[model samples]
Target: MAVVSLEGLSKRYGNHLAVDDVSFDVGDREVMGLLGPNGSGKTTILRTLTGYLRPTAGIVRVAGFDVVQEGRLARRRIGYVPEDAPLYPQMRVNEFLAFMGRLRGLDGQKLDVSLGLARKRLGLEDVGETIIGRLSRGYRQRVCLAQAVLHEPDLLVLDEPTNGLDPRQIIEFRTLIRSLAEHCAIVVSSHILAEIARLADRVAILLDGRLLAVRQVKASGSIRLRARTDLAPGIVSALRTAMAGVEIAEAPQAGGMVSLHVSTAEDGAVDQVIARLAAAGIGIVEMSEAGADLEETFLAVTSRKAFH
Candidate 1:
């Protein structure tokens, strides 16, 4: 079941379209990545879903409640952590958490139990007495996250939650987000491609305010081959002659070598290519096959068509 859905969602400022005709769905108990470069309209979509800003057109829904039409209800069921989680400067950490709990209609023993749960979930039990202004940036980020989920909202929308965190903090944050998926749907937008790739079960890629593609994050290994230095002369010509219509996807031409990336599972095919190259007197540079790199797939899909 989809916990978060956007239908033809669009946001515009006068003549400039910040997000255009975007649509995607995030499933229940799943981590969905909203990814793009800076200003790729990723944040715009997050803001709309959070109901902080109304969309120029289309709808944002959370757990079946329309974000704009039923914002109060939708907001109650969703936790939001914006890019900069603005906290009061002087509020004591415990007091701040109480305030956050109250905002979610939690109080007394109920609030106490809920607050305790959030604190433990976020590893903030030890710092409960620290002032908001006195904590380090990493801890401050944790506080922000703590407040967002204080209500135990069914959905969590985080905009760059790992931003301003150290490497260790980032790891902790990742584990925290993963833990949330046990009971809530999560949608996180980040420019850190590898981080998202690591955590997300599905990905929605946007560009120029348009949805480029939505795809499953593949984990299967792949094969990569590098030509040995002894491949005879005219090896490039040999490859071209042997595999007509085969496209050279990538491999920088350097030191008089032409390397190429191919997706093949046959072992002898590679050996045959090398043997043929040697017979043709074409020098073969380094060659080996390895796991299918997702980064390579992402670039290849996003890049312009390769020139054969």
Candidate 2:
């Protein structure tokens, strides 16, 4: 069974349907990215998942417990960090983490161990004594994460986890989240496709309060090709007609080598693509397997339908 599951989830604000029949699941050890533009139901989904807002229809479950009916159990298994990661400005970093840990029912030796682990895991030891208001944005974000994971929840949910982070800090935070996957399932909500590509094992695209598609993070059965000569317009057209639904794009290349990225929705189409290219008189000088990038897929999915 999935550790986190949303079945036919929907929410409404008076006349507005904020989320519409959204459904997806995140298994143990999986990192699922929830992607959508602003007001596209991504925030609504997260809020519903965390039990902050009740669903107008359908159900949300965490660790097999229904979020609404078993709110305490479900919430206990989830650690959440919102987009802004609000923190107490006057409290010291260690103090705040300790306060959060105790609030979650940890105490004595166990609380100490949890605090120690959070400090080391998030690299907060150096800034433990620093006040929250004085810490850099990156360190403050880390503190927020530390508090979220202090109780060692079975699932972690982060909304725009790297929103205000510098490039280096973003990289570090991504690495930290990936490491956390070894211990629990994670759901990251973001509008940044590239960051989602880096952190998520799978991606769920949402648009206008509806789910568009769910895609695996790693591409399978895709191929990259290099040819000595540029593909003629006629050959390109012929290849497109011969292998319908196969996506082929000319990639930028240096040293005059023409590169083509090819992927097909149908099974066993790699050979068919190669044959079509050869039949079209385009010589395949090199061939290698490649992953389908999320950026292109994201654009294609979101652009499919116009949204207000």
Candidate 3:
């Protein structure tokens, strides 16, 4: 069910190496978030995937077609929405979509059906006759998506699809992306961390032209263990000895609490560690899971080199 695959894909400028031996497989019906800071080579990777730029090395496959060798087939099967979606300013929405559909080799009832679906799914039904220049930025983005998907491409490549959208528009965009999950594989690249955590089925963080980490949308194992001891010595050593992989995360004497983040190999180790410390004469004030969210994970991994 792998719809898109990139192995050792690399691109470089004259003196600077951009994407270095980057590789990953995108499965069917997946919404993958591509994350990175500015100038992190994210745009380069997307451009290469869309065939706007040929890679200096490695292979890229979209819907079982090689991006370079079978360039036409690959391009035909992919719906690419760049950060700045190209739209003819004077063209009417429906007219532009029809033109785009024709370019994709879609015609007759089949093409009509595709347009219908795009309009309904992307909430562009009422704006069909509006000129592109008069539409709001959010609606314009939707129009861009409508054009990209007017022919129902099998693989959707969206680079910062929700970049300039308002909060309401951002939510609507997320809903549209989730609904499209049944038909095509999607790759959405954005620097907004929270949005990725909420919308992505998986996440890949890129930095300085390299992929730092790739992860599923599973909840990270996180805990905030507060050290509370009535005695003067504190429970610092007790924490270190009893809990493996536990580090001092926060310690506030005014609050009479010392918070530590515990990372253990096995599951449910937090409760056990807390029980052990309590049994050994240490006091427990409060225990809760901190924000080990995707943003935190993205920051942690991307700050370092690639973790494979």
User: How many steric overlaps does candidate 1 have?
Assistant: 23
Candidate 1, residues 1-308, lDDT tens digits: the string is 57998999989989999998888888889889887888889899988898888999998889999998899999899888888887986998789989989978998899999899999988899999988899988888888889988998889998988888887677667778888888899999988876776568888877767777777866432324455434423455675677534334455556644556654332234444555566777654466544545566556656643111
Question: Please, what are the lDDT tens digits per residue for candidate 2 over residues 77-145?
Answer: 999999989899999998999999999999999999999999999999998889999988988888998
Error of 1 at 33 (Å): 0.5
**Each model's Cα RMSD:** 11.8, 10.4, 10.8
Clashing pairs in 3: none
Which of the two candidates, 2 or 3, achieves a greater lDDT against the reference? 2
Residue 103 lDDT, candidate 1, scale 0-100: 79
TM-score of 1: 0.74
lDDT of each: 0.77, 0.85, 0.80
Instruction: Give the candidates in order of TM-score, highest first.
Output: 2, 3, 1
Worst 10 residues of 1 by lDDT: 263-272
TM-scores vs. true structure, each candidate: 0.74, 0.76, 0.76
